[model samples]
Target: MTRQLRRPPETQDLSRESPTVSVVLLSYNRPDYLRQAVASIRAQSYRSIELIVVDNPSPSSAEIAETVAAQGNVRLIRSSVNSGYAGGMNRGIESAAGRYIYLTEDDIVLDKDCIRHLVEYAKERQSGGLVSPVMYNKTEGTIRCAGGEFALGAVYRRRTHGEGERDTGQFARPFNVTYIDGATMFARADLFRRLGGFREEYFMYVEAVEFCARALKAEQTLTVIPRARVYHFEPPADANASANF
Candidate 1:
């Protein structure tokens, strides 16, 4: 407790100071999912944001470009070569122009106030490197991942409480978490640049965990805001990626 209060103050600014955010969505061959994802961004209550969709080496990605063009503030980039997840995200971040940058998968659907809540939380913690919401499985309505814990050999992402479980009194508290799910994450642009972007080495698995380790090692906090919520489209029997882990 004393140690927490003794932490140094951060110098970064996180006000609604500006509503601009460059939201990046990286996709491969999932055009249908991309459409819904782009639409979710377009529907954000925070209107000053722009959308960047990176279509990585898909034969039909051009059609995604055409579809995104219909929306005024969207910028679509189709990569000639497949850069996988990390590379595609890097390309999108390079092109993003906003004080804050957000990343999400093409299958997510955001609530209108999603960005609003994230921005507000970030503002409260000026040096926060990453912030995310409590995510529920879109299909099952079960909690997916709220935040994570780094211990032993790997980080563990915790899911929701079991049915009929009583709400604890700690529900209102906002605390530092080990890492946020990359499915929906927000960060200040400068902090992101300082972190050197997501590591492209791991390809898919453990990217967020690695990034969180780096951020926490630097004394930057990763927070979870319960008020900000989203639904993750994880199919019931969807198994974790094998080789990526």
Candidate 2:
């Protein structure tokens, strides 16, 4: 109708310039945070991505749908029960239709070039199945992590921590980290399938570690590219505590 035709073009960048990347952003009850997460993806420099927001049983899919209705190429999938991060994200991965699958959470705000740079870095590395960007917490004004390497046996440090430490490009160079945090990482769709996705046993914590271990077991490389970045927000109270998210 003429009225519908009079509507102006939306400011949201829903253009699917490249269909190679599929972002699987898992969400729970945090609708506000989820809104920001989806907006970040919509603002990405890389335009060839399809965003699949796998809602962990959002009570009102209609409300969530209305939130993202204007964002092109965005799909919302909901689970019947509360599936934790592992299970929820696994469902997202299974339904992804891109060559590169990106995993992220509702609290993370990705830099515009995060996906572009990550994909480019992975392409250059060729062998790496997983790639992560440097994570920063704006509220704390500190580096959450650069990337992590395994410690003695099963335990491993999460790279950088401490108020005294600085992230002034000291660990800026990309390196072969032992593993990448799944909160905001890119994985090859085929490789993700080959690894059988995240082990549902993990539920929430250790999902990334378990996935990386399986990838390594099957001879897949994991790397980090400082060029790519994402802003990860954490509560002031839970800033230092490793909460089982």
Candidate 3:
């Protein structure tokens, strides 16, 4: 089951804008972080954006709806079941009307110019299929993920670049990468729709990796624009979590 909160009348004018960027923010059981993330997106230097909030059956569903309602120009989609990250993102993407889609998680805050930088870079590099910003740990101020690639092996493994390093301008230059972190991804709307969004069978983990791999196989270039940055408030790993999938 799914419910959609209507957007305010004032937000209707957003469709008139050319080349609008739709931001699909996936939230699950974290209302406070959702508020902060929404605030950061609203504060972006790029103003032509439409925000879509997908609540993945959060326990705080009412609070999530309230937060989204308080922020005008936001469309809220509430799911009856927790479909994990991939499904939630797909829901938002299906309703997106922008030429560009910016997929993000609830606990990350974007830099004011983050979207602007991404849009500019994407336009400059027409062949780039996916572009993502450099992510830093919000509390630790250390690199979370600059960009990443898979290790050549029979099993799936990833090698993240500059995972725990300080901002020393080493990964500052924009370059091609094997995959972009799922926390914050920017790409053309058509590309995502054409690829049928993410494979929901995996539920949460490795969806981004598989999506990127498919995109690469389709001859799309994945890249990281280091100038654009986002701060991620990543939670501690669950002790019970396993890689059995």
Candidate 4:
């Protein structure tokens, strides 16, 4: 999951059909990172995607609005309150108009082909639903996780693989994962609506996991597409929310 080029993709052919892909980028107070996230989406090779920036209401709401205004085709939704990641994403999902909904943090910088590859892979799957890409730590240039897992019994330690490894293709092959990092997730819009989006009660942490848990109950598959990649930058001290860290 390191942020280096892992050989050129054999095909740049994004998707046979250009279905609208909506990206719900959640940002609380990090304006600079928000701009980077929006710009990265705008720079994507796939042109059919729409960007929905859900800004948790804060003192910097006006500044965030101004920054999002500069980016064409991106819709800015200002929350009346700082309704955590769960609420923000639910609102964004409501506004999304794509066949696929991609969840991302404001601190992430996606590869140009990230959306393209994701949509292509989604169309390729027979019954897959939630899918995510390999997340690389921006500055450290190391693996964050191929996908996430949880240990049973006492601690229930949440684990992610290839934490500090180089981009050597050790965990390169695509596989089914327990949970995908909330930083970047792509799924079908129909399935998301059917699943009722993220539970607004959880607020931030464990919301995605809870959503995936329900998906499992419904017998849906969560997958990882190794070819799709994204750069997850270091987050603010508070982890997106004002004081949720």
lDDT of 2 at 66: 71
Report the lDDT tens digits of candidate 3 across residue range 50-88: 899988874578999999999999999998777788788
Candidate 1, after superposition: displacement of residue 145 in Å? 0.9
**Candidate 3: what lDDT?**
0.81
lDDT of 1 by residue, 1-245 (tens): 00111111323334457657778887765667667777877888877786788877665577777777876667788887775667777777777767788888776778788888888777766745688776767777666677767752454443322222223434355666776787677888767767777777657746777777777887887887777767666672223221211
Instruction: Give the range of the ten consecutive residues with the poorest summed lDDT in model 2.
Output: 1-10
Off by over 4 Å in 4: 1-16, 151-156, 235-242
My TM-score estimates for the predictions, one after another, are 0.81, 0.82, 0.88, 0.87
TM-score result, candidate 1: 0.81
By lDDT, the candidates rank as 3, 4, 2, 1
Order candidates by TM-score, high to low.
3, 4, 2, 1
Candidates 3 and 4 compared by lDDT, better number? 3
2 or 4, greater by TM-score: 4
What do the candidate models score in CA lDDT, each in turn? Answer: 0.69, 0.72, 0.81, 0.77
User: Which digits, one per residue and each the tens of the lDDT, describe model 4 over residues 1-245?
Assistant: 00111221222223447978889998877788788889999999999987889998876678889999988778888888877888888888777777778999788899999998888888776545789889888888887767877532312346776776798988666788777777788887777777777777676677777777777777888788888889877544245344641
Query: Candidate 3, TM-score vs. the true structure?
Result: 0.88
Clashes of each: 0, 1, 0, 0
* Between candidates 2 and 3, the TM-score winner: 3
| Lowest-sum lDDT 10-residue window in model 4 | 1-10
Model 4 CA lDDT for position 40: 91
Cα lDDT of candidate 2 equals 0.72
